[model samples]
Target: MSIDGNLLTLSQWLSPAFPVGAFTYSHGLEAAIEAGWVHDVVSLQNWLETVLDQGSGRSDAIWIRSAMSDDANLSDLDTLARAYLPAAERLREAERQGAAFVKTVNAVWYTSFPDLLLPLAVGAAAQRQRMDGDAVVALYLNAFIGNLVSAAQRLMPLGQTPAQQVVSAMTPLCLRLTVATRGASPDDLWSNAFLSDIAAMKHETLQPRLFQS
Candidate 1:
């Protein structure tokens, strides 16, 4: 596809309108907020950057890279992605969104790759549809970050403009990571956001929760 066409495709796939149930999960941001680790815009931005660089987001980027490549061992990758989730809510968030994304893309995009993990499914679909690999990674990361930020907005005193500003500020980092992970393999999938992982585990018991995780 032309560059414009590819950009349009990514916009559609990553749009909030995509029926992926992404709004239902916070990726542990709620718990972080509850714990006061992410109470304001600066803290939220830092938290999201950590996720994008060293947390599950980075791992998912690697998975997406594998899925978009010809040598992807999808079943094994799926298992790894599943086992890599640090907590139950995180696991549920991935699986539910993965299933929804797989169903929607298969029906709409007209291919039937197994409805596996979210990152893998999206990577497979991007490859099947011949979307630009870097664009796929960048767009996917942005969507993931955007969803979490939206959840934060609902769960805290964050305003719309600042939430979007955080996203905008993270764009360069997103593109840089997309480039960095371009040659990544499934074996490289790992995360180091210990605080986020802990938050996800704690979110299971967090009271008065507005998000699933």
Candidate 2:
């Protein structure tokens, strides 16, 4: 595909209407909000950036790179992704969204590649569509974070301008994460955000929750 085609494909995947159930998962942001860790716009932005930097950015990026390189070992990467989910609800969210994404891509972009986890499927799609690896990774990361920010705004009372600013502020960090993951390995996938994990775990039992975590 040409660069224009690649850009269009990236836009589709990164769009909020992609139908991968992204809007349904806040990656625990909703839980954070209820817990008061993300009561304001700035706190929400910091929470999201921390997740993109210390949590998903570090672990999922490594998984994407590993799956891209070792197609035969995709299962191992998937298993690792699964294991990294410290909460039951979070695990189910990842697996559910991942299966949906893989099915969609297989039906549309049908390659001989094996079924992939969420990050891996995204990476594979980027590769097949000839999108720039770093660009695709950054786009996905930002979109993922953007979804959380959007969810927070709706769940809370964050203003439109503040929400957009939060998303804008994340751009540089997304670029840095994409560049940093260039040499990352599967073994590098790790997160120490136990409080977030605990909140997600607690969310599973929270009465009347808005997000799947």
Candidate 3:
């Protein structure tokens, strides 16, 4: 496929309309909103910046890049990805979405992606398709952050324009992380987004929750 064709495929895989059910999971942003930790645009941006810089956002990107390697150990990576999660809700969030992504991709593209975490599943698929690693990880982060921004809109009084602004503001940081983590190994897969971890844990008990966590 041409370069344009690869970009088109990546865009579709990471698009909001993908069957991965990404919109259903907010990575605990719902709990943060309820707790007033992210009640406005500034706070939301701050919260997201931390995640992208030092949390699952960063770690998940590493996982994706690692999985995109030709010699990637998909089974082991999936196991580690499951264990690296901080909360059961988070594990389920990654697991269920990943399963859906794998199923849809397999059905449509005829690739074999075992049940893996969301990042690993996406990585393995991208590897098989010969997509660019940096672009794959970058767009994965974009979709990840985009979904959270979308969730914030539904959970709060945020408007479409502002929601877009958040994603826009996050683009450079996402790209930076992707660049920084290039050629990174699983040893570099670490997340210190503690508050987000707590939020995901707390989300399990949040009453009248709007997200699946």
Best by TM-score: 3
Write the number of the candidate with greater TM-score, choosing between 1 and 3: 3
lDDT of model 3 at residue 206?
95
Error (Å) of candidate 2 at residue 202 is: 1.5
Ranking by lDDT: 3, 1, 2
Over all chains combined, what TM-score does candidate 2 have?
A: 0.92
Model 2, range 39-85, lDDT digits (tens) per residue? 88778877877788888666777776666563436767777777777
TM-score of 1: 0.95
Q: Which residue pairs in candidate 1 have backbone atoms (N, alpha carbon, C) closer than 3 angstroms, thus clashing?
A: none
Global lDDT scores for all candidate models: 0.88, 0.77, 0.91
Error of 2 at 179 (Å): 0.7
Listed in order, each prediction's TM-score against the native is 0.95, 0.92, 0.97
Candidate 1 per-residue lDDT, tens place, 1-213, comes to 445776787788789998988888999888899989998989999999999999987888888898888877788889878887889998898888889988988888787777688888888888888888898999999999999889988989989899899999899989999999979986676788999999999999999888888
Model 1, C-alpha of 173: deviation from truth (Å): 0.9
**What is the C-alpha lDDT profile of model 3 across 1-213, one tens digit per residue?**
445688899999999999988888889999999999999999999999999999999999999988988888899888888888899999999999999989999999998778888899888888888998998989989988999999999999899999999999999999999899999988987778899999999999999987889
Pick out the ten consecutive residues of candidate 3 with the lowest summed lDDT.
Answer: 1-10
